[model samples]
Target chain A: MRAAARPGGKVTIAEVAARAGVSKGSVSLAMNDKPGVSAATREKVLKAARELGWLPNQAARSLSSAATQVSNIGLVIARPARMLGLEPFYMEFVSGIESVLVERSYSLLLRLVHDVDEEIGVLDGWGRSKQISGSIMVDFTVDDPRVAPIAALGLPVIAVGHPDLTGGLPSVWTDDGAAVTEAVRYLAALGHRRLARVGGPATLGHSMIRSEAFAKAVADLNLEPGRILPTDFSGEQGARATRALLASAQRPTAILYDNDIMAVAGLSVATEMGVSVPAELSLLAWDDSQLCRLTHPPLSAMSHDVFAFGAEVTRRLMDLIDHGDAEVGAVPTPVLVPRGTTARAH
Target chain B: MRAAARPGGKVTIAEVAARAGVSKGSVSLAMNDKPGVSAATREKVLKAARELGWLPNQAARSLSSAATQVSNIGLVIARPARMLGLEPFYMEFVSGIESVLVERSYSLLLRLVHDVDEEIGVLDGWGRSKQISGSIMVDFTVDDPRVAPIAALGLPVIAVGHPDLTGGLPSVWTDDGAAVTEAVRYLAALGHRRLARVGGPATLGHSMIRSEAFAKAVADLNLEPGRILPTDFSGEQGARATRALLASAQRPTAILYDNDIMAVAGLSVATEMGVSVPAELSLLAWDDSQLCRLTHPPLSAMSHDVFAFGAEVTRRLMDLIDHGDAEVGAVPTPVLVPRGTTARAH
Candidate 1:
């Protein structure tokens, strides 16, 4: 393959080593920036490789026996810290990741960024410095800008989204669309005619999927499709959205929140406005948490084990890092756990 | 300083280099495990240094220009993940830590352990491997096992506790004792004779301090003291504790919770049991969060800027890493933010 690459073909490390008049071991050490090789020799090897246009196969280099592995896996989240403080999803997810990581003697290197560009920069730096062996990426948006850069850099990554959203990266995701349908259908069956959703940021792929599914479910049920209020998934926004929806002339009789916190907030708003729960209005939470049960009426929620889901993603990430082969799979669809929050619309 | 530590005189890195018949530069490189030194030369330097009893000064080694600084800070939290999932304290604290870290281009390496033993092991490994430049330790229980081992390992650390709990490490803390006193006194002035606290785990240093302060305040005010129920700080545990307290024959008219989640839970339990807010019972929260405002009748809180507190700890950690000089100081004491949850007792 090296001979064929001389004109046009696969270029091997041996060709670079031979051209630089260095031993194969020296070439390997030089390429990896290991301590054993001399600076002049490393320069020669690099010069030769550059002349031959022979880039070390990133996957191959990462798998080299002498590669120094850092004992931490990277996760970069791009969200406002205020939002993260209240969001139970990330904390539960991180807990699940740690459950698997602890047994394997790995720590989690977590960073919060303002946006995807910063996330990409962080991952690239971590990859270049070999600071993290692999990373788990979440909060994938439609046409995510992260996928190509991650692939180009050859960083071992397991995205937490559907395959299409992840840009071909290995993923572990829940069936959000089906869950939304179930939630809508359940609310519809409870004699609710007008309904609305307090959704997450519109840019998030999962939120988009939920919105589209919500639209479809409403159409199928032949109910007036209520407005979808997009937010940054903060309780403040949840309360604000709830206030707006209730104040409108065409107020929603029942409201569905994207997560438990929002649902709790929406419930509080209803009470503050003197609206009786499940009688004057109905509330349903998308992601169930301990917060759901702690509320006044014990919110009915679309419940799933987020901790277990996080663990599953970590498991696939480990598989990707070790074998370079991974397949996408969905965790169990969120099921409706009916409680006191929902009742027949008045 | 080096001459003072020698048998006859101070034996510095220069003396070791002279004894090994190597350049001073080589000795520095060998000691730091940097490139540009042969294996045999490194061994010779090590032997000569050992024979001379010229141990490398850990502080000086850390400060050396050649030290390969890892661009990440370590944080080891010993707690159940389930508890961590709903607690708003850590997320707020972490966000504050990140506010400072992002400016310096540092990432946070977070790990959760079941107990202090595991925390110690994780930190030891990270220190040995030089995977973190420094660390911030939190949630110190009574007689923390981490302090001595961490100090012995010469790993830079900033503890987030009062001086007594920090075991002589530089610290950043809030005045929990003062805050508790203020809370008790405020409730007492509000015409409440019977009072109780839903405290955090009794093992935690802060919890113990708060408990002690609560006891003293009760004695000072000459009011009927109420029981302090210890919990794991989970919302479920909070709910359970509230239930137990409310069901007791001599229930307290006012309750103070260790965190907002617990306060929220207590409020829910009160509502569930047909207790009225402020009319029949008053509730107060420690460690205020957005959850407070989102609750029905908005909970009163001992409000402090937890994000700012976290940033302060990170600031001190950074100082410890850079100049090796930091003094323990308290952040602002939490102040009473009275909302709908607290009022004059009926």
Candidate 2:
């Protein structure tokens, strides 16, 4: 056995093993409470470790071959923190991610960045520092700059966006285009010709996809050209878009929103403007949170289980980390749930 | 100089220093970009580190005397993840905490546990592993079991609850008691004799504080005995409590909710039951989230800036970490923000 060498007077595991009259490997198994160690040996190791005042330094353990013992998964969200707080999608998604992570005794290292560039920097730092085992990337845009650099880092990652936008990265995504088409078809079936969509920033990959799908759906139904107004996904902006659509020369009979908060805001705006819901205007919301049910004329929504989506994404990432690769797939498309906010157009 | 020793074939700073023909301290200074190293020395160290493919391991650095280099702050929320996502207060508070942390280039290590016992375990692990420099504890209940164990861990923590509940930990809290009293007085001034309060779980420290204050305020104002119902802070429970209150033998002329979600839920229940808000029933909400403004007859609220409050708690934690102590103080109390949902009872 090696003699105790207290570097900077801090107790080392080797010293504990030396004191316990066991090999370093036995000490590790005993400390971690893994199998292959007898109860007597484990007790002796624990007593020696206690007497030596040795706390298992996870940092040192990470440096050795036991890197798998470090259980931290990174999630970098590229959005304004203020806006992120109000959006139910992320919170629910994180909760879903947490549900899966807790089962494995892994922790999620969450960071909110201003943009993709900042997110890349954060991810790169985490990768080099070995602070995270894997990462989940969100909010992909057209020709996302993060794809190339992040891929080069060779860190296990799961991108949460369209396959085209993710640049061949392993990804789990929702078919927003299909969901949008379904929503338009449902509204058209209800005898709506003049349709409008209040979308998120046009630069967002999913938003652009939804916009294109909306236009195609309108054309296919032989309806007038659909109006698409983009916003920053804020309630105030959603209210403004609703007002503009209502006050237009040829006011649309139906409006679709990118999220429930904006949909709720549009509902309030309709009430304030004395425009009756489902009578003068039919409103459809995306990402049906509890907010949809809490509204007066509970909103119709293109609803998908976001919590399940989050769980699926996490499961894929975990698979990638454990088995070195995971299959790329699409989650369930959002389906139209016709609530009080939609009715036959007059 | 000592020859290169690759125990696990991982390049160390000592190897880099030997290759650079400089001291290990100079190599560290150059790598961290700290002052005291000359420009030429810095360049030499960088070149050697690059040639050796040496990436500074943060975990190893944390184990060394430079433990301050690790910049993680722990935040554990002891609530069900499902409920946490729907509550805007926590997300906004986290965002606020992040805002302050970003300025200092620190990161928040967030976790959601089942209860206080789980939270204590998580905190203890974090403390022992040196994964976090400090932590922020929230959701204190009566006779919080966490105080003594957590205090014993000797990790710097800022408790977000009343002093009595925090059990001598440095704390930052809002005056919920004073706010409840003021809310009762405001309703009484509006000629509301029959008032009702839908509170959070009675076991919660703040909830108990508010309950006692409500009773005292009712007695002091010579008003009718008020009805207080407690829920799990869910919108569904809020709706159920509202229905129960409205169905009572002496229906309240005014109702106050513990959160904006519950208040919004209560509003929907009132509308469903054919009760005219402010005409036959008045509603007041706590924690003025955007949901309060989105509702029809925008909810009147006991409003306080939760975002700012979160920022303040982080600042205090930072101070405690830097200065070894922080002052216990109450933030601005929630003030009445009367909007369309409140009026003089007939």
Candidate 3:
């Protein structure tokens, strides 16, 4: 095919490389915005390509891939966040993914699924129908049925969850287990012995990991088991859990909320019930959402860059899917966002 | 094509209507889940189809019409909201859109773009290329260069912003004019003669409408000028604006933020600056994000169901693209959410 007379025409990778005085492979790398090619070299290549009017043969490349790929990534999330909207983390992660995708002229196909089974079926069917290049897996549960079913299709898969639960596929997860321990240690340093926790759904793999860590940390300190309450990670459940904890005869002085939504809900319930934060009782949160800073007394949280985490996963997935089993592992470290929610335990 | 042998081989619309003792058109209405097929006839047709194990041939219909339509709705969004993660509004709106899409055997293609020009190019190209059957448009600006350009391509479009700005395409929007007036009236009722607002981007079609209403309402109440500060609808900008306003000697008693992120950011800044909310200052936000409830003292906001708004737009877009010309009109009106941030300016 010949280049069009219009502003942007087909500038081949060879022409780009020739203009930049580099190899075709180098031009390909620079055009795809991959690292190792210096920022200056990448810019020069892109500028040259634009001047030459180049568009990557994205559709053809996808069609000719070794695995009979579909040229796009499919992400099926469990339920829509609704009032929660796509959080900053999700946005940043998506931007990170798109940063790479747009360069390759690839698309990300996102969907909201009502159930795990439905998602499993969708993944299977889309793969079978050649509608996706690869899939992004999230919200894994113990003995995850989705993994087994998807694995059966021999589709290139990358999971965004703990590896232990993901059947050895390339996986990415935040260090929830270590993060829970850090939360306990942070509270302990503030002179709190008695503690309570409002956890997310016990079925989720990350939730279970964190719950176990909380127990082990408490057990090491010889604390009571009745203080831990597991509920679906939602604001309503958080409010209910807070009320029940506050009503208990052995009410703990410090409370840990699994996510920001629940922490905010706990904050409300505490206010309504007349239990002051970091005064009469101390509180903390996991998954530091912007909600933490919005409350009267801001919440201290176990913070991990969810956006970066998601971005990192997308990057690794692209690598593995493209290069066939690239090394994939992310450092699971948790940073403490010490806000006003926790104090020297009353 | 051979049937997969799931139940009764290919129980066509003819068979469904025959079983239900209705015409093929009635069966079409019933199977497509559209209104006006009568509840009795619809139920009977569905039951008969279920027993016979049939699925709709959307592809066949499209091919017959010379419409190589992909089974997905293209959702293109502009600016800061897209940068912010999945807010509950989009999550819920997308959820609502998806429910319809899935039931109709369609998928949703969500995209984020930088500006109107990029969008115009995308829509024009996609429509011309016949890659996407139709698109959902949002954030209408006055003299929107995008309007005539996309229309010329004859691509089906549905706007989800101000009706007047939509160029007669079917539109879905919350009544910003009414909502703004009510917000101003509420603040005036609370003895707030001096009120300032941090609104969305200047180029946005709805922002212009809201700003106009704000000015009108403020003047009607005989208030001062230079109180409306239009922002890019970002958390950082909102915080910065809040700081500048609060630092001034003539700062307003109550302030309104365009969206929940800005409200939350402003609230945080106030707390950091030792400002007492509802005591020293009152704050309100538009778009009723969950950030309101998550805050210490929840925010009071101009509330409306954005999810329903999105779904409504999606449905209209699908109809326009698949069925023909646009169905231009008004949608729902916005309401107020009374939360903890707004109080009497004593």
**Candidate number of the best TM-score:** 2
**TM-score, predicted candidate 3 vs. hidden true structure:** 0.77
Per-residue lDDT for A1-346 in model 2, tens only?
A: 1111122236788999999999999998986656899978877776676555464654554354322345778888767667767788887898888888777767778777666655665765666556678988888899886766566556789989988898768888999999999999999999999999999999999999999999999999999999999999989899999999988899999999999999999999999999999898999999998888888878899997887888888898898888887878788889999899999999
- Write the residue-wise lDDT of candidate 1 on B1-346 in tens digits: 0001112225688899999999999988876657899978977876676556454554454334323456789998887666667788987888889888877868899988876756765665566556788999998877775665566556678888987887766677899999999999999999999999999989899999999999999999998977999999888889899999899999899999999989999999999899999799999998888889889899999998888888888988887788766656788899999999899987
TM-score of each: 0.80, 0.84, 0.77
- Candidate 2 chain B has its poorest 10 consecutive residues by lDDT at B1-10
Question: Tens digit of lDDT per residue, candidate 2, span B223-242?
Answer: 99999999999899999999
Model 2, stretches more than 4 Å misplaced? Answer: A1-68, B1-68
Where does model 3 exceed 4 Å of error?
Answer: A1-71, A80-96, A99-104, B1-69, B80-82, B86-89, B124-131, B325-327
Task: Give the range where candidate 2 chain A is weakest over 10 consecutive residues by summed lDDT.
Answer: A1-10
Local accuracy of candidate 3 as per-residue lDDT tens digits, A83-176: 2243434544555565555445455677666667557646644554455677778888887756544554455677777877886556767778
Using DockQ, give the best candidate's number.
2
Chain A TM-score values, per prediction: 0.79, 0.83, 0.75
